[model samples]
Target: MSTTPRARVGRPRATAGSTQLAPRDEILDAAAALFVENGFAATTTRAIAERIGIRQASLYYHFAGKDDILVELLERTVRPSVEFAKTLREDPSLASAAALHTLAVRDVETLAAAPHNIGTLYLLPEANRDRFDGFRASRRELRDAYGAFAMDAATDALRATWTLAELGAAIIHLVEIVIPLRRDGEMIDAVRIADACLRLCGLDDAAIAAATGR
Candidate 1:
């Protein structure tokens, strides 16, 4: 007699109707929504799996666990700004005011383009843990980019009274708080926000207008 075939083990592949996305992407999308809607601490792997109509074990096919999903989402939220900030730092030809304006506009646009307000994840206590060190490092790079522009704008001792660190923090505030709060429906006027950010960095009206081409 022929032996019966051994039953397949482990989570089955995701069905097309359950998610049109490739399994990994579908899991990331679901995890991002849940992390944004319900704080990261509160969002479980099972909930993420359920959101995409997959078994909890299937989530492991894409991610090791909830923390892996969260770290990936945070990286997606911040990596573009980090990469662009590096470019600005390397390009000596870019003027201080122009660099600041360019960074502000691009950073705000990246934030608005995300599927959810992933920036909000920065507030989660879990984000401070060692596992999220990459996210912290990326943010610091962006902050340092802002500091460089601030220092460049301070051409004289009198003008440099405000610390570069303080000026940099102000720019971060504009991107993280002001622009999002001031959005017109789903659209954020990145140019307008960038102009405001330059003004915060102590650039006069003419300078702001010139840098932003407005």
Candidate 2:
């Protein structure tokens, strides 16, 4: 709804919920878009409330303030990837590093495309650092899962090569790159970038090809 900019906090997972949360999510989603388009300092909860066709006072019932809405936006956006990556990691039948890389590729593309989500997350203020930590921990579960997968693929070289760390950084950096892309008003094409980054992360040409299904 809104595409501006704002501070980013942790993104948690989206779960099965009722229609009541839907309107709240709509408000947060609009706020995130506005935050990405404008900037956190410039964004107004009133504007978000307006975008949702509601009074500013009504917005308070769904979220406490701007930061709370930002956090909700984050949860709506980022949590699914972590959850999905966990599912992939739990599969014992997974054969190659390519599998993990492949799963990451899909998630990376999704993460990269959601610039409003990314921007809002970064706009989170330091005073909100405690909630930020919780957000990070919630999302980190997926990263930890992927790291394990990456390390396993690297012949248990998690520490020796820091494969998990490297891969995790690579994945997150892909998200970070979206920050500027959105600012520049460029095409937020994630698949193209994800392809190249995955290669650099040691996903072989064949694996990348398979991941892209191209």
Using lDDT as the measure, the top candidate is 1
Model 2 scores worst on lDDT over the 10 consecutive residues at 10-19
Q: What's the lDDT of the predicted structure labeled candidate 1?
A: 0.78
Write the residue-wise lDDT of candidate 2 on 77-176 in tens digits.
Answer: 5677777776776777765465556665666566655636454455457425775665667566656655565555543333466656666665566645
lDDT of each: 0.78, 0.63
Off by over 4 Å in 1: 6-12, 16-19, 155-159, 178-187
Query: Residue 145 error for model 1, in Å?
Result: 0.9
Error of 1 at 180 (Å): 4.8
